[model samples]
Target: MSRRLEFSPTVRQKIIERDQGCFFCRRLYHMEHALPGDLAPKDIMHVVARSHLGLGVEQNGVLGCRYHHSLLDNGNKGLHREMDSMLQDYMRELYPGWTPDSVTYHKWL
Candidate 1:
């Protein structure tokens, strides 16, 4: 059996409300599997990638649909940078300890 991340119902609701829907298109995502058997809760890609430098908090994350997530991962530099900046601002306000240097924004892309 595979282990699944179990987030508190309150946390999940907060995430949904924070994004106010989709992080990219700002629309309501129907909450489905990205593919056929993925168990993830289905969220948007972090503009500044959690693995790369994202803060690993709700503010650092976006609520993108699978399509936008793909576009971000496939090196869609332009949109990626734009979203990164937006998320960064939100993070700075949410996390006072967050420094700009903590994450490198690829604005040129």
Candidate 2:
């Protein structure tokens, strides 16, 4: 079967500019493949996650490496929840009233 693929050049450029290129490792101008795999070059994970209310927008997303992406996906929820709590600590510091449950995503986004 044949499959069609789509990617947003505008979003890619924006992410490249915003992250100075690499997302997870924070490198610059890294090359990326269309999908994730060992053959895929080091690049950002521009997720359109169903759990994050993400609309493929640059702002409503995250940057991660392939390894980290896999870890985040298959890692234990307790660890993930801990990490989320730590992240929320920073978010609450900025927003003041942000709660842990407010931005928590059951799935990676």
By TM-score, who's the top model here? 1
- Pairs of residues clashing in candidate 1: 44-64, 77-109
Kindly list the per-residue Cα lDDT of model 2 for residues 1-109, writing each as its tens digit: 0111122577656655655523433432222422445324444442433344334444433455565555445544334544344434544555577553343343443
Q: What's each prediction's TM-score? A: 0.51, 0.45
Model 2: residues with Cα > 4 Å off, grouped in runs? 1-7, 21-40, 46-48, 51-53, 82-109
The count of backbone overlaps in candidate 1 is: 2
Superposing all C-alpha atoms, what RMSD in Å does each candidate have to the true structure? 8.8, 9.0
lDDT of 1 by residue, 2-104 (tens): 1112234555566777776556554322224245333234564454564455433454455655665765676454555655566677667777876555543
Runs in model 1 lying further than 4 Å from the true structure: 1-12, 27-44, 92-109
Give every collision pair in model 2.
Answer: none
